[model samples]
Target: MTLPGITPYDGKTLPQSKAVSATNVHEARTALGNRLRELRQLAGQTGKQLAESLSWQPSKVSKIENGKQTPSAEDIKDWTRITNSTSQATALLASLRTLETQHAEWQRILKGGIRPRQNALAELDQKTRLFRVFEATVIPGLLQTSEYARARFAESIRVFKLANDINEAVEARLKRQDIFYRSDKRFHFVLTEAALRFRLCSPEVMLGQLDRLMSLSALPNVKLGIIGFETQYTASPWHGFWLYDDDKVLVETFSAGLNLAQPQEIALYATVFEELASVASYGRSARGIINRVIADLSPDDAEA
Candidate 1:
């Protein structure tokens, strides 16, 4: 799904410069800041005056107005109230929340390390009854083995310079897997064949992960589908996304995580998912593809 100000890219190529860049979030923040500034000026209050009235540091006002800082919901409310612009509070808060959702940078989210992020996801997992996941490259987190998960986390730590909480993060991730036994929840995972071949982790670790996928596929509550290279595609596998029931769709990018809750956005993703799922191989067919990958990894022990 496209974020505000960003143009949707064609599946074949990267978006051109005319398309909104990653700075959309910052630009959105700047626009909101300008609106707040207008409210203050219309109320005849200088930046220092507004800060003094709100009992905030003068720099807080300047940073916010300059889009260097994101104001919390309460901060927006206070600012609007003091400026006698309470009527704008609703719209301003909505903008702030949207910015927060669209600009959840991994660096900021993982500032406290990975475990907290894992815990937060677990909380969301507890609330979701059905998980519809599509992975274009790597295994989905819920279906990942500890070794595979550790490899993924290590890359995150390296890229984002996060704390070395790999052990705690891995434990929390495995804890989330407990939900797989609940029986009340359902999971449908669609993965492209490329997901199996990616060398994100060592061959041995990936073999274990493939074996885990084989076992998980047999669960009554889980449906695993693999889109082999031979399958004719009905939809372009542009990227991976997770659909938590019909409430929201989560898309992960290199820099940020997008949380989309708009009804239209969810509908679009659901439609694309069905198109991809229709072309995926399931049951024995899916297992055959996984087994082939396993054999390729360990040709000497295909029986193993």
Candidate 2:
């Protein structure tokens, strides 16, 4: 659903209502990366210098700063030593350990085995003022139907070797959709054309998913846009990212999710979102695309 500028937070509270929310592994990693970068800069250390001090390669420092790699606690301690901020380094090391504790593969949440992960997401869905989602390959979880979610989650479980709790996981996912219907919040989604047509489950299941997309696009508070595969974007084909207001960002990769908390990086993600929105189809044109996808599914219903 597309939420207009109107937010539950009054104009006065909008500034203060901004929050920092990292509901998953990707988000935490992003946040940690931002912190590391900030501490490095505050200490007036260059990436090359930091790497030399840490006895690691410069590329590794760059990857950590860009949220490309999940930094180990040892790496973080070294980063702090290079920056000459012993106290700050220790604090961040603790946070990183907390993030990595017990759960190593965050993708497991989708597959049905990570119950805590699923619940953490639900809790975030309860309070977020805005959800800015750009999906490169499939529907955002907030908008996914139970069938599609089950298929996606089940596949994740098998592929990742996570626990098989598809039934409970699917139920949690469906319940998570309540945020869309709530009058107090807003959800906006920017989907790649490939994602619009990506059939994760059966033809019937995809149809249901598309139909739901159409329905969600019509909501006054929901804004759904599709980026055609052929069209050029100002920020073309960036990795899938979910920006939750000014508080956090979830950057997805093949191996892990990066949670970003630093204000600068979150701002960067928001800027990218704006650029993506600028190039995407909206309103009537966007609705027409959704309708066309739905129409294409009608004939295949019998086959399913």
Candidate with best lDDT: 1
Clashes of 2: 18
What's every prediction's RMSD, in angstroms?
A: 5.8, 9.4
Quote model 1's TM-score: 0.76
Superposed by TM-score, candidate 2 places the C-alpha of residue 20 at a distance from the truth, in angstroms, of: 19
Candidate 2 per-residue lDDT, tens place, 1-304, comes to: 1122223323222211112222344456677888999999998889898888877899998988876787887787777777888788767877777676422446644444655566888887776889899988888888888889888887777777887788887887777877778887887799987887877788889988888888888888899988876678666454688888788787655555666666655765676677788788988888777777777767866667
lDDT of 2 at 269: 64
- What local lDDT does model 2 show for residue 35? 90
What is residue 43's positional error in candidate 1, in angstroms? 9.1
Off by over 4 Å in 1: 1-94, 299-304
Candidate 1 minimal-lDDT segment of 10 residues:
13-22
Error of 2 at 87 (Å): 12
- Report the lDDT tens digits of candidate 1 across residue range 1-304: 5555544544433333332223556677899999999999999999999999989999999999989888999999999999999999999999997899777878788999999999999999999999999999999999999999999999999999888999999999999999999988999999999999999999999999999999999999999999999999877788899999999788888988877766756776787788889899999999999999998887585455
